[model samples]
Target: MVIVGILSIGFVVLAILLVLVRFVFDLRLTAIQQEADHSQLFRRKINHLRKIEQARHIRYLLIICLMIGIGLAILIGSFLVLMDKQQKLTAQNQIDHERIIYLEKQQKQLMANIPLKKYPEEGIGLEEYEWEKWSEEKKDVNLQRQIESAISKRSAQYFDSFDTKVSLSTPKTISLQLKGYTDDDASREMIKSNLDAFAKEAEKVSQLNNIHVRMITSVSKEKQVVYSVNYSRKKSEDKFNKQNVSEQNLKNSGEKG
Candidate 1:
């Protein structure tokens, strides 16, 4: 549009200049034709001079018009380039904003958890030592009591939430709702195996039964189950499964299996 507008304006200006040149030439020609003796000779010179002036004027106008068109094209192209850059930058800005929010949520969740007390991982059995710490934390944290007191209490305040439960039961079958971060077995098994191991050790734990372990995450306020497995007290073939905000069931607070 800009290019067309500029070219159109150049054409109009050229037409006006041509008309003015014609009018001047006509007046000069009339004067030259009036003389008697040298009328013919003067008329020829006037015609030649008019042609030269016309050529010079048209050339100047064409050059000016071409320069204007080129200027308009450059200006419009530069504006489009700026607009394209702005759009890409806006999209990148949005992605950065989302990433920041995700990191902040992770930080908050970490801050809410219990601080770690490092123990030897090589020689010492984890269950023998960790149970003392677990017992203290399980009793100390106000939220765990609420969950332990009643199995049905599904949610709790942030930081007040720890994702583990140990029970004394001798039932034919047991259901385990495992909490995990990823879909991989190493990641998912952290909670499931951790619970199963603890359950085996805990007083009157199931020995001969079908234990169903489910790996799930939180979606909105509800639990989203991602993986599931059914096995017996004796080792059995493993089978599959899931981001949750408020984590469920951890023996140690502030840490993930």
Candidate 2:
């Protein structure tokens, strides 16, 4: 498209140059004819006039060709530009569609495994170990208790709003919700900055509790912000399975004995 546009401009310049040259040539011929009146000069003048006329016609033809070339270049350039833009838009839409599908699948999985009061219309979602509640009868009882304590301490230090909810469960999942405003640019920046600070602060406590943190943020059309944090740790699959295998072997040996 850029090349075509440049070529179009070049043709226009060429046409202008041809017109100026023809004008000068015409003036020169008129002056020479006015100055020459001798018989020999009159014959030469007539022949020269015929040659000038032919040259003028050729110049006119060249200018017309240049004009047509310029018009075609412009038309082709515009078509190419529109086609390129359309292709880019189509690719972007496809990428966005794929991303949406992936996120929806993840959201469904989290909703199935975890209990939640509600889901946002649009936002990032992630899954991690649950650390909100501590259960005495559950495995890893000590770790669960420590995680709950850490979560409570961090929540109290960072957030005191009534809207904030810090809950711990048996598997040790910490669920936190923070309400924020985003009515303007300053408010939006404030929301973003506070969320970052809160996440980092919570994550610091999470590391001490030996758990992972997943932070999800959503914004509504009204510019309200919702930052949700899920903190949890996954039980070691290999160790648990090995322990079950060992217990079964011991039981079989006792029966044989």
TM-score of each: 0.29, 0.39
**Which is the leading candidate under lDDT?**
2
User: 1-257, model 1: which lDDT tens digit per residue?
Assistant: 46656665665566667667767876876676676778676778877886786687678667666765665676677678779999999999999999997875685466345332222223122223222332342333443344234431221121122342323132334344533233233433344444344334322322224545454543223333345555554422222111121335332332334
Off by over 4 Å in 1: 1-44, 114-257
TM-score of candidate 2 versus the correct structure, residues matched by position:
0.39
Q: Count clashes in each candidate, considering only residues at least 3 apart in sequence or on different chains.
A: 8, 13
Deviation of model 2 at 12, angstroms = 2.3
Candidate 1 has a TM-score of: 0.29
Q: lDDT tens string, model 2, 1-257?
A: 67777777777777777777777877766676666455876878666886878777686977768696876779777888899999999999999999997876565444334322111222111113343323335546666555545544434322322134444552333455443222244533443344344433334333222222222222333223333333233342211110111111112223311
Worst 10 residues of 2 by lDDT: 240-249
Cα-based lDDT for every prediction: 0.46, 0.46
